[model samples]
Target: MARWHRVFRRWVLARHYRFAREALVPHFFDALTAYALELSRLGVPHAKEAVAALRELRTLPLPSFTGEVEDVFFSIEAQLLEHWGEEVAGALRRGLSRNDLDLTVFRAYLKDRALLLLGDLLRLRKALLARARAHFGVPLVLSTHHRPAQPTTLDHYLLGVEALLARDTERLFRALSGMDRSPLGASALAGNPYPVDRRRLAHLLGFAGPVEHTLDAVASGDYALELAAALALLGTSLTRLATDLLRWAEAGAFLVGESLAQGSSFMPQKRNPVVLEHARIYAARLLGGVGTLLALNHNTPFTDLNDHSTGVLEPLSELLEAGEGALELLWVALEESQFVEERLLSELSPEVMASEAVDLLVRKGLPLREAYARVKAALPGVRPETLGVEREELLHWMGLEGFFARREVLGGAGPRARAEALSEAERRLKEDQKRLGALRARVRAARFLLARGLEDPQAEEGQEGEVG
Candidate 1:
C-alpha cells in the first residue's frame, strides 16, 4: 500500500506540484516578502530576520524538494525552515494560510495567462479584419438551412465573424477585470487578527485591491467560473468560424493555402484543410475544459473547499491553453486563406437574386404576397418576360453589383452599409487595442513594485488608470 501510494503520488499528483513550482512559487516568494515587510512596519517580532532571509533566498536558486512534502505551500515552508531556521519561517507565516495564499497565487497566474490570451484574440481579430478589407465587394451566395437564400459579399460574412469574436473579446476582458482583486490577507476562511495591510499586499502583488470580505475571498470561485465561461464563449465563436471555412473550402469557394493544407496518405489529390480541422478540435477541448470546471464547482459547499479551489486549477489551465491553440491556429489559417472569387461568383445563381426580385415587384405597385406568388410561379426557369418586367430591369436586379447597390439601408448587405460596418469595426479594434495596452501597463507596474519590495508613488499613480 505504501509503494502504491508513492506511485500514485508520482503519476497523479506530479502535475499539481509542477504547476505549483512554475506558476505559484515566484508569486509565493513575492507574497512572503510583502508580508515580512508589512510585519516589520507594524513592529512585529522577528520581522527583520524574515525580511533578511527572504532577500538572501531570492539571490539563491529555488531549493529542490521531494513530492512527499504534501503541497506547494508546505514545501515552501519546509524549505524556509531548512534554509533560514524556524525564526524566519515562523515570522513570515504569522498570519498566512494555504487557503488564502493559493487563491492569491491562482489569481496572479490567471491574470498573466488572460493577458496572453487577450493578445492572441486581438491578433486573430486583426487577421480577420485584414481579410475582410481585401475582399470587400466579392460576391457570394449566402445560405440558410444549407440552401441558397440570398446574395452577400465575402467581407460581410467575415465581418459577421469579427463581430462575434469582438463580443468574446469583451467578455474575456470583463472576466479578467473581475478577477483582478487580491485575496492574500484572507487567512483560512476568516480575516486574520494580525495588523497586516491588505491593500499594501495587493499593490505589491499587482492586484487592483484586496477583496473586501475575507470569507468571500476564500470561498468564491465565481471569478474562475467567469473566466471559464468567457473561454467557452470564445471556443463557440472559433468553432463557428472553423466550420464555415471548412464548408467553403469543401465547396471550392475558399482556397486553403499549401502551407496549411495536408495530403491524405492514401489519396493522390487531397489538400485537406487540416488547420481548420485542428482549430475545431481545439475548440472542442476548450469547451470540454469549461464543462469540467463547471462540474467541479457544481453543488458543493462553497466555503473554502478544494472542489472550487485547487480542483479548478488544472481544468482552467487546460481551457486557457486550448483557447490559445485555437486562436493561433485560426489566425494562421485566416492569414493563409483566400476567397476563390471566380468560384464565389459562379455559385451565385439566379435564384439567389430572387429576394431582390420580389422586392422590385413590390416597389412596382404589386402587393407583397402577389409579387411573391408571381416570382414563385416563375421559378425553375424564371425570366424577365415571364414576370412581366423589362428585360433590362430584371437583368439589373439579377446582377451581383446591382444586387449590392439597391439595398442601401444601414446594416444591409449593400456595399455602402458594408463599408460603414467595416469602418466601425476598425474603430472598435483600435479602442480594444488601447484598452489592452492599459491593462498590460498596470500589471507591469505591479510587478515592478513586487520586485523592488517597495511601492513607487509614480507606479501607484500609473496603476490607478482604469481599463475602461
Candidate 2:
C-alpha cells in the first residue's frame, strides 16, 4: 500500500500539487461555502454538517496532506468524509466537479496575475512618457531601411513606442475582461442538476457573473490563447524598440548611463549596452512562450481535457512575470540613456531636406523632374538661397528644426503635436488607472465577503436572504 501510494504520488501529483494548492485552496473553500449555502437553501437534511466540514477543512494545514493525497480537492473530500461522514460529505459534491472548479480557480489566479501584468505595462508606459518629455524637441534623424529618411524629435519616437505599448495594455485588459464570467457551476462538461445559484458563486468568487453556456465554460481556453498572442505582439514591439536602441548605441547616436552598461572582462574600454540586449532576449522568450501556449491548445480536445487544465497553465504566469521584467528593464534603460547631440547632428545630411526643396522648386514653377535633378546635383552644399529663394524666406525649410515645424499636423513630429500627444497619454493613463482600480476594488470586496462566509456561513445566508 505504501509503495502504491508512492507511485501514484510520483506519477500524478508531485509536479503540480503545490501550484494547485496555492491557486485553488481559497477558491475551493469559497466553493464549499457556496455549495453549503445552496444545499441549505434547498433544505437538505445535512447542510449544517457540510458547513461544519468546510470549517474543519479550512483549519487543516494544506501541506500536511502533501503525499497523503493526489490532489487538494480529493484531499478535502477525504477530510470532509472523515469529519462529517459520507452523508454530509456527499452533499459538498452535488453541484461541483474538478472541471469547473479548476477553471474557476484558474480564473481567480489569472485575474490577479493579469492585473499585475497590467500594472507593469502601465509603469512602462509612464516611463516611456517621461523619457519623451525629457527629450522633447531634441532632434534626431529618423531612418527608414537604414538610411536617413526624415528629421524628428526624440520625444516623437518615444511617444510612438508608448502608442504600441498602449495597444498591449488594451489587449491585456481584453484578456482580463474575458475572464470576468465564472465557470463554477459548470460541473464536468455540462452542469449539475441540483439547485445552484451560479450568480452567487460568481459573486463570492470575484467573477463579474456566471458564464452562460455550461459546456463552453468548461471547454474554452481562448482567453489564455488571446492573452498569449497579445503578449507576443507586445514582446515583438519591445524587441523592435530594443533593436533600435542597440543600433543607435552602436552608432554613437545614443549613450547608455554607466549603471545600464556592462563591461567585457577582457576589454578595458568596453561599455556594452547589454540591458537592451537582455531586453531583446527576453522578448524572444516571450514569443517562444506564446508559441508553446498556442501549440498546447491547438490540437487538443475542447472540454476539460489535460491540455487545457490548471497544470498546463502553470508556466503562463511566469511568462507574464518575464514580460513585466523585460518591460521594466527596458524602461529603466531608456530612462537612464541620453542621445548624443553631436553624433546625431553629424548624421543629418543636407540631402535629407531634398523633399522640401523639391516642393519649393515646384512652387517656383519648375517641373517636378527638373526639380529632382536640381536637388540631386546640389547635394553637398545645398542651401535654399542657392535655388533662387531669399535666405530668410527659405530658412523655414532648411534645418532639422525647420523640418520638424513643416510637418505640424496632428500626430506629427512638431513641438505642439508632441505636447498634445503627451497630454492625451496622461489623460488616457488616468482613465486606465481608475478603471483598473475599480476592478481591484471589486475583487477585494468579493474576497472580503468570502472571508466572512468562511468565518460564519450563516452571516452570508442572512445577507443572501435579505437580497432575495
Candidate 3:
C-alpha cells in the first residue's frame, strides 16, 4: 500500500508541478518583471529594487520544493521571499494573481510546443517532397476501399500524402493563431488595478496582442482543445499513411529497408517493419491523449481551476512529443522504403482498368450502361487487346504509362501534374521556413530583453519594433 501511494504521488500528483517549474518559471520571471515595471510606473515605492532582485533571481536555478505544494507558483513564491526579503519580494505579486500567471505559462508552453511541432511537420513535408521527386515516374496501383482502383505513379501518391500533411500544417498554424494573444494582465478573472501595459507584456512575450477580456483570458481552455484537436488530426493522417505502408509491405508490394527493419530473435527469415509499427502506436497515443484531455476538462467549472492547469496541459505535451516522434519515424521509413516494381505492377489487377476500357467504348458512340455491361460481360482481367479498340488505342487507354499520360488534369497523378505540384510544394515549404525563422527571431529577441532588465518601462513602441 505504501508503494502504491508513492507511485501515485510521484507519477500523478507532483509530475506537472515539476514540469511547470522547469518549463514555465523562466517565462514567469520575465512576466514578474513586466508587472513590477508597471507597478513602478504607477508610483509604487521601491518597485525598481524588487524588479532588479527578481531579474537577478531569474539567473538562479529553478527552486526545488517538497511535494507538499501541488502548485509550482507557491514554491516560486517561497523562493522569491527567501532571496529578496519581504519588502522587495512582496512586490512581485502586486497586481497579478496565480490565475493570470498560470494563463500566461500555459499559453507560452503551448506556443513553444506548437512552433516545435510545426517545424517537425515542415521537415516531414520536405522529406515527402524529396521522396516524390526521387520516384517521379515510378508507377504503382492506387487503392480504394483496400483494393486496387487505378494506376498512379509513386511520386503522385507521395504528393497526395504531402497535400494532406500540408493542410495539417495549416491547422497547426491556426492553433498557433489562437495562442498569439497574451493573458498577462488578466489578473484572477478581472483587470489588474495597477496601470499595467498589457500590450507591452504581450510584445515581450512574443504574442501578437493581448487577450481583451480578463475573465475570458483566464477561463478559456478552448485554445488547448483546438491544439489537441489539430494534433489528433495530424496523428490520424500519420496513422493512415503508416497503415498503408505496413499493408503494402506485408503484401510484398513495398520493401522496407534493412536500416528501418528489425529481425526477430528466433524467426530466421523475419524482416519486421518495426518503425512503421511504432509509428502507428505513437499515432494511437496522440489520439488517446486528446480523449484524455477532453475528459479532464469536461464539466469542470469554466473558470480558473486546477483541473485545466498544468496537469491537464501535460498530456498535450506528451501528445505533441509523440506526434513529433511519429512524424520523424514515418519520414525516415518513407525515405528508406522502396517499391517492388514487379510486385506493384502484378497487383495492378488488369480489371482495375475495366472502367477505362468502358470509357473507350463509350467514346466510340456506345451508351454508358451498354459500355459497362459489355466490359463486365467479358472475363475478369480481360486483355486490353481483346477490347473493341485498335492495339495502339487500347495501350493509350489501359497501359500503365499511358494511363498516367491521360490523367493530365490539375492535381492528377500524371507526370506533368505531379511535377507542377512538387514544384509548388517546394516553394510553399521555403515560404513557411521564412515565416518560422521570423517567429524564432522574435522569440529570441524577447528572451534577450527579459534577461536584461527593462531600462525604460515606457519604451514599449521601440521594443515592439525591434521584435518580429
Tens-digit lDDT track for model 3 on 13-83?
Answer: 56766787777777777777766766665656667777788788778786564665556777766776786
Residue-by-residue lDDT tens digits, candidate 1, 1-468 = 243366657755565677677667777767777777767666667776777777666655554445556667677677779988887788877888878888888888888899999999999999988998999888888778987788788889888999999999999999998789988888887787786678877877777888989988888788888999899889888998899889889988788889999999999898899999999999878776667777787787878455347669878887899999999999998888888888876657777778777888999999999999999888865577779999888877778777778777877779889999999999999999999998889878766665556654643322221111
Q: For candidate 3, what is the lDDT? A: 0.78
Candidate 2 total steric clashes: 0
Worst 10 residues of 3 by lDDT: 459-468
Candidate 2 lDDT by residue in tens digits, 6-68 = 765765677567777766687777766766766666666677578766766786777644676
Q: CA lDDT of 458 in candidate 1?
A: 42
Report every candidate's CA lDDT: 0.80, 0.77, 0.78
- The residue pairs that clash in candidate 3, if any, are none
Candidate 1 pairs with clashing backbones:
none
Name the candidate, 2 or 3, with the larger lDDT value: 3
Return the lDDT, model 3, position 277. Answer: 97
Worst 10 residues of 2 by lDDT: 459-468
With candidate 3 superimposed using the best TM-score fit, by how many Å does residue 55's alpha carbon deviate from the native?
2.7
Q: For candidate 3, give the lDDT of residue 255.
A: 86
